[model samples]
Target: MPEWWTYRLEDFLLFSPRVYWRMFELHNAAVWPLQIPALALGAIILVWIVRPRQWPDLGSDRLVSIILAAAWVWVAWSFLWNRYATINWAATYVAPAFVLQALLLLWIGSLRGRLHFAADRTVRGVVGLALFLYSLVLHPLVAPLVAPLAGRPIQAAEVFGIAPDPTAIATLGLLSIGAGGAIAWLLLAIPLAWCVVSWATLHAMGASESWIPLTAAGLAVLSRLWPRIGSGALR
Candidate 1:
């Protein structure tokens, strides 16, 4: 394993108990599972109602501008909340990272949209797979940092101007779904989104990291081959 991997694994294991407790809250038994269906239905209803009145301007700068504006909104909200709550630096960091993920997706999706590459099967599939992997890994990696700060008092920090609270960090972690499956869903979603876009963009630019997509594809194929060969010996 890479030196970084060994280090991170050690850190993660050290915090396993806290992580498990946080995981419980993330997957708590409540009205949480219904939230998935509710939110999905609401989103579908929203899109149906707001169906594009004009053909989407795939080449418009508006895509970029809107993305920037949305990002600023999150930042501004965090700034004010942090100011009043005296948020800890660590808590503030968590929100910005989550916002960055959304921004990245919009940026990539918009690029593909502008180039009219969104319809291409190969492009979409590659992006989808990369995102799946990224989302999964990113969560567990960052969890340790924020998890340790959860028990801190909700008092403002002079540096960050916001108080650090478990609620905020946990939510930002996508582990606040109040249940376990929700934690799993978020863990799956965020990294995958990041990877798909990053891989697609790098591949398009013909960067050396293009090997990443190939590696992912190879592993996927190998995974499929594994079960079949193992079954044959048993049969």
Candidate 2:
């Protein structure tokens, strides 16, 4: 048997590069124009995090949490297991992780009232806000930019709730904005893993966006740690 260490990255790629791109093309068509409302809601979520008092009702943020959780489940079933898994076997395992994350979000935010977002102007909070903006507006543009650079036609832009890329990015921001704890870490595991997996996939595809997922993971960590450090709290 071949030694695992002798395996190259390409060996693990089960699909042709063209097939991978085609998947996104078909996905874009399947979810055409849902991107608009998804992007709009993402932006509103960012604004709400920045000025949470605007809602002024206790547990009102629960609505946003519910929305985010629903998105997680949506991607798990709709994109990962239903679509992407057909081409990449690994995504089948990843799909259940996304489902677990969704349940975590719902359990913590909706049932337990443990997950909440607010603006504190602390180092962490500011970083969280920045991540939120990145996921909402800037994340979609990433695909288009990488397309020409990779000598491909413009790629279908993905948005939060409607697709995995933005959903992963937005989840990073949410984890950062909420109180970081064991439960937060639990919620964070799958997204962080997805980012790493995505990094490898993009790298294999010769897309410049290859590295951005890892970068988002790093930023999410920093956003989580910065405030805790400043307050001399690390748990």
User: Which candidate number maximizes lDDT?
Assistant: 2
Question: On residues 1-235, what C-alpha lDDT tens digit does candidate 1 reach at each position?
Answer: 5676555322422223333233324332222453344234323322322232225554332242233224333433544223312422333544555465445435433443321211112322233333332322332233343444543111211111111121122112221111122232333244334334334533543344435434443343333244346641222
- Please tell me which predicted candidate would have the highest TM-score against the true structure: 2
Model 2: lDDT to the true structure: 0.77
Ten-residue region with minimum lDDT total, candidate 2: 226-235
TM-score per model over all chains: 0.29, 0.89
Please give the TM-score that candidate 2 achieves against the real structure: 0.89
Least accurate stretch of 10 residues (summed lDDT) in model 1?
Answer: 154-163
lDDT of 2 by residue, 115-140 (tens): 77985666666666677778777877
